[model samples]
Target chain A: MSETRQINVSKSQVPKLAIIALGIIFAAGLFVVGFDQGHIFSLVYGEQAFTDMYLHELTHDMRHAAGFPCH
Target chain B: MKTSLFIIIVLLSGAFAGLIHGTVNFAIVEPYLDQAIGIENQNLFASGEEEDTTEFWVEYEGYRTWQKSGQILAGMILGISVGALFGIVFALSRNALPGNNDVKKSLILSGIMWLTLYIIPFLKYPANPPTVGDGETVVLRAILYLSFIAISGFGAVGFYQLSKKLKDNKKIIALVGYGVFISAVFIAMPENPDELTAPMDLVNEFRFMSVLGVTSFWASIGIILGLFWRKLSSQKETTHYN
Candidate 1:
């Protein structure tokens, strides 16, 4: 009788969950740093956030340095 | 690799690389920013937009402090964002990438990404200091810049995918195709509407430092993530003898 050899191995699957999570991070972070202009804060603070522009002012230096549109 | 571990590695790598980029900007780019802001302040004063009083100086100092501190924090955030994209691409394309180790392959991808996503877009719309941009046209400029980046990136990708289907000897056509297409798009795009009022010397120097800051981020992410991926993937591949 001939015996068959079996090797125990695990194949990796495409990590969809991780990719989705990272995709969200990419979009959210890009917005906060690159082009907030008070829009994100406006979600909570109403129209006043546009004037405060807390995130925008905070990221002002970097936005310009990193080649984003900043006024 | 496990999902949680992969996410952790990608985020951490991005944060570290971004931190490096932020620190570099502090050392090399901050002075130019200060200089440009100084000119902006002078313009505001000259135009009677505000009186240069102690009160004004106090508010200015407060915001400048916030802006400066946020540089590092923002760098990390931006790092995580761009790094996420890098991680995703690296994971999917690892096998297709060339090299005996993950580090070399990671670096090659980073260079290609940096060129397609960053340098090409930058050439069409270079970084400008504060004084150079106009508030009225910011949205327009943003659209133009973003459009060009997308075109350059997708154009390169589309051509590359096509190359995979062609004979090896005919692969060079994709390269030529990308060059010609991007050149056409470059000419078609509108010039930055804002007039260059800042001193050419100041503008040019700031742009140079800006490029350096962004480049550091790309290089660090490539090395850091490559090392991490190699270590973890090796563990995953280990075989146990019963």
Candidate 2:
């Protein structure tokens, strides 16, 4: 393909790529939410709910792996 | 055109994501098992002989309900309002010639706007010792307000920065910064049982989750609308360019 045509093709693909990335992020988020059901409850409540649920769950899992009583 | 549409798509997608994810576990997955287990009574600790329920349970339930409803409503309103406001601000800021330092101006303006709406309220009502139901009610209400403001403000900043950095290597930096701010708030949350003035009513949790779901859904809608507007404008520009 000519350089101009290559650029056009790549430009057209940006939106498609963004959509795919978003889908992956959303799926990962759901998985995190499902895994941390208990903490999800806590995070949903007023005090702690403002925090990103995904990060909290990941941190909790890490803590558990490192032998912390995250529960 | 692409940027606006991207914003809208992200907002809508995030909202639906929140709602579906929030409901799936409680409404379907867990409830099915609970039902299959043949649960005799959900609340096992309730004393059968009690004539008047204890004030703790009563206050807890009341505050819980209030928090849930307040959060949902706040989330929806905040998400849309903030999203639109951010989009307009972003569009206007970017309209300036490239390399003009107007991005900093826009960021500063947004920061001021956020501080005025989100932070001032907390400053007005600093976190106090847990009072009776009154304290719980007050704090929960404050939290809902703060959450809406913060989400909208931070989301906008993230969106704006993401737009600017779309072609730059710093896109991840912008996204991660917002992510860290949000995660820090969660981590810093005081988890002491005493700090929780409200009782842990399971029903209340469901209610709160529902509100969050709705908020996420609407915020996404706002983003979608904003994207549409941007797309239309961009198409006009493209036609002119052609």
lDDT of 2 by residue, A1-71 (tens): 22221111112223444444544553344333213333444645744653534333333222111111222
Off by over 4 Å in 1: A1-12, B235-242
lDDT of 1 at B214: 94
Q: Which parts of model 2 have CA positions greater than 4 angstroms off?
A: A1-71, B1-80, B83-167, B170-185, B189-208, B227-242
What fraction of the reference interface contacts is present in each model, in order?
0.57, 0.01
At residue B56, candidate 2 shows an lDDT of 47
Tens-digit lDDT track of model 1 for B152-174 = 98898899899999999999999
Tell me the tens digit of each residue's lDDT in model 2 across B1-242: 46546556445533443334334323422332223112212222343523334774685455444433333233332343344444444444545324334334444444544443334333332222112113234334434544544564666466556757576776676666665665555455543222333233432443343333333333343344434443343333112221
**lDDT of candidates 1 onward, in order:** 0.90, 0.39
